[model samples]
Target: MRLNGKLAIVTAAASGMGRAGVARFVREGAKVAAIDISAEALEGVVAEFGADTVTGIRADLLNPDDATGSIDQAVEWLGGADILWAHAGMPGPASVENLDLDAYRKAIDLNITSAALGAGRVAQHMRKRGGGSIIFTSSVSGLVGSMMSPIYSAAKWGVVGLTKSLALALAGDGIRVNVVCPGLADTPMKTGFTGRSGDPAEAAANEAKLIANVPMGRLVQAGEIADAALWLASDEASFVTGVALPVDGGFTAR
Candidate 1:
């Protein structure tokens, strides 16, 4: 077990990449506290993974109190946190032209602000334990412009900046901070962003458009991205820090 005797906290853990990440970490022998905004989904995770291994918490990362409180709750439940994956995110409102100002603010808050807040709170906890790893989920959109979602790209780019600066700030404390820039993945956010209708033909067309651009010729799987997260969280990546790792199947290389 790569993470045996470790305690991990994963945000947005009810579905998609977050859920897969929580499961991956637990499988590596970590006691994980999984957090999501949906209480029902959290309950489902608990039932599927068992309360002994996964502790589920309902938390809205956009809420200031909830953002920091989730870390506190996880520490209380899991005893301590050796790894923190701040991975909650949203697609925001379609394009920049149709961007809802309120939703844009929320998208920024959820994608970047909450990540910073969570990291700060978690850092405090990890400091007592001597050190820990903190990984933030960014996107290939952060590395390149996206005509479909500008605000989301902006927020992810912000994550890259935050991760580097935090790594330097926490280095003396033995903490490592890094960002994962995943390409198009088979996740709920991907479906919500690209899907326009329930029509099968329309869905296939949407997927085809994205696949054509990917160097791998298909969308990445959620578990694949979680694998990157696991490596960053594990001791295998001990010397790695302040990196924007593109788990994007060479999409950004083009």
Candidate 2:
């Protein structure tokens, strides 16, 4: 019960790392307000966790109003929030060659701006309660460089920068801000993106190529990422802040 009696908000909670975080937190005795853009998927989460343990909120984080409003709603529903996991993001265009500016803007909004807006609103609530934890999801591309998606790399890099700045700004109020930079994970995002080629052989080859780059030779599990987040959000990391921890199977170590 590491988070016994705590309350939390997890965005992108309908699936992947966000859903895993919600489950882990709840198991540790925290009630969660799960926010996602998918109404049907949100309903599924509520069904899986039960209303007593999770409240589902449907809102598109890419919209500034939805981003901030969802945070307010979550805080209000949970009475207060002790943790926030801003995990909503998308893999943008595959390359910069003839890049669509509109796609670039959308990537920035979803990958970084939403986290900023959500964190800003949640920090206000956290201040009233004395302290809290804010976690953002970045990608290994943020720490290094990604040839596949320069726009995504830029946006995730922004998330790391935001986390560090917010940590310093909110440290005095006992708020801890950190980010998790995950490598290629065994999630829909990864498989779906690789499968975009629509050729099984090509998709498999692409996946194999990505895996070969990881020292561990495997995709990082969503549960593993959740465990990292659990520690950061728990009292165990009370003195920790402003760190960009990588759960990338040694991808960044190289």
Candidate 3:
């Protein structure tokens, strides 16, 4: 168990990469405090994981108070928080010129600001305790330009900056901060983006076409991303910090 005896909170825990990471954390012997905005979906994930291993907290991460609240709740539930996975994020149904301003704000609220709030609390606790690991779910879209997604790209880039800045600021305190940049993974969220095109079959085919461009010629599995998070949270990465490790297969390679 890579995370034996550790405590972690995974935001956006209802589904996709977040859900997978939460489950893997539990399977690796970590006590997890999982958060999601959807009550029903959150319950489903909790049910799937069984009751004895994890505690599910449903909350809107867009609210910084809620982000801070989640940390406190996790500490109360699990005795003490040692790892934080800021995995909550959203792309869009809109292009740059046409995207709703409010939607973009919401993305920033959920993606960037909430991460800062959550990490701040986690760092404080870790600082006092002498050590901990913090992981952020950034994207390849942030590292390379995505002409179709400006706000998401901007927000993800902010995550990279945050990871580096926090890493330096907290190095003296023994807290390590890092970000994971996942390539295209086939998750409910990714599926939904394609399915939204109004033609289900066509949308799926379209998604396939996009995946074919990757050198690996396959979608990155949820578990694969989870494994990266597991490594980041483990002592094996003791000397690692402020790095954006790409779990994208070969998407960024080309």
Candidate 4:
């Protein structure tokens, strides 16, 4: 119960790492406001976690108002937020040759602006509460260049920058800001983006290629990434801030 008595707000909480983080936070004794764009999915999360431990909010974070609104709603319900996980992001269109300008813009909005905006809003409430922890999700692409997804790489790089800057900005208020960069993960996001096939031969080829660059010989898991976030949100990392911790199975090491 590292996070006992804490209140947290997590974006993109309906699936993948965000959903895992919500569950982890709850297990550690934090009341979570799970914000996602899918109303039905949020309902499912509420059902799984029970209304007492989690409150689901359907919000399109692309709209600036909705991003901050989600945090405000958490404050109203949970009283105030001590842990802010700005974990919402989209891979966008991973085309480099025929760069999709629209996709790039949307990626920036979803991955960079949304995280920064949400963290800023939550920081205010945390400041009033005396202290807090703010965690953002970046990617291994943030530390190194991504050949297949330039726009996503740029957006995640922006997250790292934002986290460092915010850490210094909010340090005086006792708010710690950090980022977690995950390597290829076996999550709904990864499967959806890769279009994983059921064919045995194709699946083998895909798995091989996916782990080729990972020194650890396997993909990271959503739960592992959640553990990193949990540590950052807990008192164990009380003196940790402005750090970009990569939970990427050594992907960025090589």
TM for every model, in the order presented, reads 0.96, 0.97, 0.93, 0.94
Superposed on all Cα atoms, the candidates' RMSDs to the truth, in angstroms, are 1.4, 1.1, 1.7, 2.0
In model 3, the clashing pairs are: none
Q: Which model is ahead, 1 or 2, in terms of TM-score?
A: 2
- lDDT tens digits by residue: candidate 4, 1-254: 89999999999999889999999999999999999999999999999999998999889999999988988998889999999999998877666678778877889999999998898899889989998999999999899987656788889999999999999998999999999999878887774345434465665576578689888889898999999999999999999999999998888777
**C-alpha lDDT (0 to 100) for residue 198 of candidate 3:** 70
Residue 181 displacement (Å), model 1: 1.0
Look at candidate 1 and tell me the lDDT of residue 57.
Answer: 88
Question: lDDT score of model 1?
Answer: 0.91
Model 2 C-alpha lDDT per residue in residues 29-148, reported as the tens digit of each score: 999999999999999999998998899999998799999999999988999989999999988877788988898788899999999999999999999999999999998988998876
Residue-wise C-alpha lDDT for candidate 1, range 82-175, written one tens digit per residue: 9999998887766777668999999999999999999999999999999999999999988898776788889999999999999999999999
Candidate 4 residue spans exceeding 4 A from truth: 192-207
How many residue pairs clash per model? 0, 0, 0, 0
lDDT score, candidate 4, position 217: 88
Residue 16 C-alpha lDDT in model 3: 80
Scored against the true structure, residue 209 in model 2 reaches a CA lDDT of: 88
Local distance difference test scores for all models: 0.91, 0.92, 0.85, 0.89
Better of 1 and 4 by lDDT: 1
